[model samples]
Target chain A: MINPQGLMIVLSGPSGVGKGTVRKAIFDHPDTEFEYSISMTTRNMREGEVDGVDYFFKSKKEFEQLIADDKFIEYAQYVDNYYGTPVDYCIETINDGRDIFLEIEVEGAKQVREKFPNALFIFLAPPTLGHLEDRLIGRGTESDDIIKNRIETAKKELEMMSLYDYVVINDEVDAARQTIQSIVTAEHHNRKRIEQQLRKHLLEVD
Target chain B: MINPQGLMIVLSGPSGVGKGTVRKAIFDHPDTEFEYSISMTTRNMREGEVDGVDYFFKSKKEFEQLIADDKFIEYAQYVDNYYGTPVDYCIETINDGRDIFLEIEVEGAKQVREKFPNALFIFLAPPTLGHLEDRLIGRGTESDDIIKNRIETAKKELEMMSLYDYVVINDEVDAARQTIQSIVTAEHHNRKRIEQQLRKHLLEVD
Candidate 1:
């Protein structure tokens, strides 16, 4: 069977939106045919964080070198640390017939979209902006000022939802995961890919 | 809890392509929220066929009057009988927040596309043209010449697959049903709809 080429999927959401939880559930499914694109970050590795699995931990100099080489598909400096998706790894994985998920922020997602316009860009959202604000404030660790800042950032992110191909509301983690899985499955059956198979079938008949 | 507006889906395929079987399986699912568009046909009702259920049987004059009144969304004359989808019924059902599936041939589907360009157009195909020919021959009811003619028509229909948004391979009935179901589910979460809901959510916060 000539399987369809794997889709390049980019997932973006504001902080505290449960994007990680939903993605974890999707990946944990044994039947999922997806590859997680590990990002390169120039941040100090926290305790218990594995080098490659957690992130491709790099020194600032190395990260800058990569940026100079134009190796990153989309890179952003967050809190003085450079973070990016390695362009080569993502392309290689997608070419290998496995969908690759790039979980990034709205800014990085936009940058990636410029490079791969055909990628399936999805946004994870809270059921409501009120619910989003509540979730951010619910975390006791963040200070009042930080929580307020996070909420504002979330509002800006929500504004960018229209740019995404699909939006999965994180009302229920399980349901959100299922919706994402469906999007991936349905995309595999798209005519753009099936047409190639159809042409081959026609050749056989001729 | 504002439900998303219903999607208008057009399923088109050649004869002996199993479009009906796939649609039946999709609608048979208890959770599938869809209304099958009842087509208006001018053909005589066969035994066990109930008017408005199997088809909306109409007299030749009545069908002609409908055509004159511009009541049909897309209608065609086939085998000396007129068949069509009532424009009002489809629009009303979709506007009521229920998805509507239009199972029609390639020509009628193209006609519907002009009115509902955003409609999700799906093409159901056999695994291969060889498999399609085998399925047509497997029925044993049609003569070789009829089967040959059907196969040629099928080839022309297959050529129209490129115009469709999605192409599902009817290799396995259950799998194809699930794929179609996924498509509906994923479409509900499209960003175009979510943006509206999100805007309302943002307002509530303000």
Candidate 2:
């Protein structure tokens, strides 16, 4: 049996689009072959956050060095803290024949797209912009003005939906998860990938 | 809400690859939104064959007229009989927002590709050439010589796999069906289609 290269899945959307809930739902499925890609971050570890599981914690200097070395697929600085997807980890995971998932934002996704255009980019869209606004307001963590700002940011982020390979509506968590799972499964059977496998099979016989 | 255009799925493979079985399994799934396209044929229908369900039986002259009128997306002459895919029916079904599955052979698929490049072309591959040979033999209706010729034809057909969008191996009937169903579901969320839907939502001022 020829071992096919695993799919690289990037799940992203505007904040409060329920991406996290949808990701969790997909991860919870027992039959899905998935590995979550741990990103490197310069932000201090929050309470109960594990260094590697939640994120690969690094100092500002260390993160900058990685940047200098071109070790990241995409990186961004937020409030003087750096966050990025490590190129090495993604390459290793995909080469290991296991599908890897990256939960990222639009800007990070754009950067990743430049590096790996073949990756399956899925946008987890809220049912509507109004629904997205309601979810942001429902969180109760931000002031009304902040919520307003978040909504405005979301509109801009939503424009990135056209850049993705699939747009899964997060009307219901399970449905969105199922749709993502289907995308991954179907992508594995993509003809270009299968052609490489078949070519190998052809060579062995001749 | 913008009604997204439905997908046209072209299922093709070598003879005796169990395309019918796989297609049935997918259609049996309650949630799969599929409408089978009824092809028109000049060949005489056998006993108990319904006019529309089995095929749109047509006279040789009528079929030729349709060909001249460009009513068929693809048409082929086999043993003095004609078989074709009608363009109008497919267009109407897809415009109605329902996915249409076209079980066509390589030549017909190529014609469809010329007409609609975006149609999802899927090749149903056998586990191996030997497996395909065994399948033809197991059918027990063909002579040894006929079986040998069929196997040779299958080999040539397999080479066309590279032209398809995806290739699903028919090692197990149910699994193959599930994969096809997934392809259909996943294609519904393709980025290009969702962009149109999203654009409508973007223009709607709240």
Q: Which candidate comes out best when scored by lDDT?
A: 2
Per-prediction TM-score: 0.89, 0.87
lDDT of 1 by residue, B181-206 (tens): 89888878777755786667654763
- Residue B166 of model 1 has an lDDT of 88
**C-alpha lDDT (0 to 100) for residue A2 of candidate 2:** 53
Local accuracy of candidate 2 as per-residue lDDT tens digits, B119-202: 999998888777787787887766798788777777778788888989888989989989998888888888876678676775
Error of 2 at A28 (Å): 1.6
Runs of candidate 1 with Cα error greater than 4 angstroms are A1-4, A42-51, A57-62, A193-197, B1-4, B42-52, B57-62
Which regions in candidate 2 have their CA more than 4 angstroms from the true location? A42-52, A56-71, A79-81, A199-206, B41-71, B78-81, B202-206
TM-score computed on alpha carbons, candidate 2: 0.87
Provide the lDDT at A86 for model 1. 92
Q: Model 2 Cα RMSD, Å?
A: 3.2
